[model samples]
Target: MRRNTGVFIAFAIVFCWFALLTFLLQFPTVFTEPWPYILLLLQTHLYTGLFITAHDAMHGVAAPGNIKLNTVIGFVCALLFAFNWYPRLLPKHHQHHHFVATEKDPDYHGGNFWAWYLSFLKQYITWPQMLAMALTFNILTYFFPLENVVLYWMLPAVLATFQLFYFGTYQPHKGEHNAENKHRSTTLKRNHVWAFISCYFFGYHYEHHDKPFLPWWKLYQEKDRSFK
Candidate 1:
């Protein structure tokens, strides 16, 4: 099969799985019992994983070509997570790569652990006015008992949006990942499994920072021999 064809097949499977889970969650019988709630939580995380995959697709990491397709897929995925406005935020993300972690970057920050922690709040929450709008939708989920929409659908949608914003915008180009900070970069390896699973192999971020065009599957191929 063609590369794009394979990617679409993979995406379809994940999408179907998410749909099935959502369907099952809609019936109260599924969540009326403790075991069902546990299952629902697990499915919620899976939905988050699917959204993450959708995110990689938007970034052209999953499949290239067709800008319209990318945009539509991203919007649908974001909408599923209750944050469909993500495409509007892409310019800021794109700028982060061009500027890296330098002063010119909107996301730039010093590597001092405490400084980075404090700066993250400011960087991520830049538009306080928008927070009210964003929170309103999320808060509604708490009051509403739409089992599938709230637990399986909306929760993952929210997590995916936050993960994409953090990993895509902040983690990859952070000053801590700079070439001069080899020691800090070493920590990436320790968490490779989670990165591979949660971010669709985006956790190999150092390699990605070096070669942005490479696909996620090929990221491990570029891993430094020294690390092994």
Candidate 2:
């Protein structure tokens, strides 16, 4: 229970920070020459956090025992990404865990990185969602500078898709796996800081597959043993 509360508070803080940054970036004066690009990089990580949070909820680790709250949090975080379908993702993710790297896994892509990413996007992105995101962007652009909207909100979300796919799915599941091992995943051997910055230690895919309940933030602590 304490862990769940801590996870909730941490997520709230990071998400609120992202929102505040987005709101502030709308003022043209705030984004001077390089600052805008710098913030975009930071925003990308924060946006990735939103997806990671929703992913945690799918595993029942974000707000344990409270299905309604978990669903609400997951739904909202996913919508913020403009490409998520959390309810649908829950079952699909479970299937990935059950039949990882096999044809039965929704995330399996035969180790083709680009193909895997596009296939991942195809699962959730639909015309209705695209139209809704476009409408929302158009409406928000009326109040915020179009550049600000694109840089801070839109680009970060897009970059985060790659970030999540690369760190969470591709690198881990790529290459050959021994058929004897049920969990077909590999771990990165980089130091903890790089691992955290890269994908919040998701490169420690073996530990994640072994213990999916530990929220992503905590994955960093178990890095040394997990990595090759």
**Which number leads on TM-score?**
2
Q: Which residue pairs overlap in candidate 2's backbone? A: none
Task: Encode model 2's per-residue lDDT on 139-212: one tens digit a residue.
Answer: 87898888877887788878988898888898889889997656899888857888878887788888899888
RMSD of each: 5.2, 2.4
In candidate 2, stretches whose alpha carbon ends up further than 4 angstroms from where it belongs are 29-32, 225-228
Q: Roughly what TM-score does model 2 have, to 2 decimal places?
A: 0.89
Model 1: weakest 10-residue lDDT segment is 182-191
Q: In terms of lDDT, which candidate is strongest?
A: 2
- Any residue pairs clashing in model 1, and if so which? 81-157
Clashes of 2: 0
In Å, residue 189's CA in model 1 sits off its true spot by 1.5
Candidate 1 C-alpha lDDT tens digits along 198-225? 5655666667666666665566666654
Could you tell me which 10 consecutive residues in candidate 2 have the lowest summed lDDT? 23-32
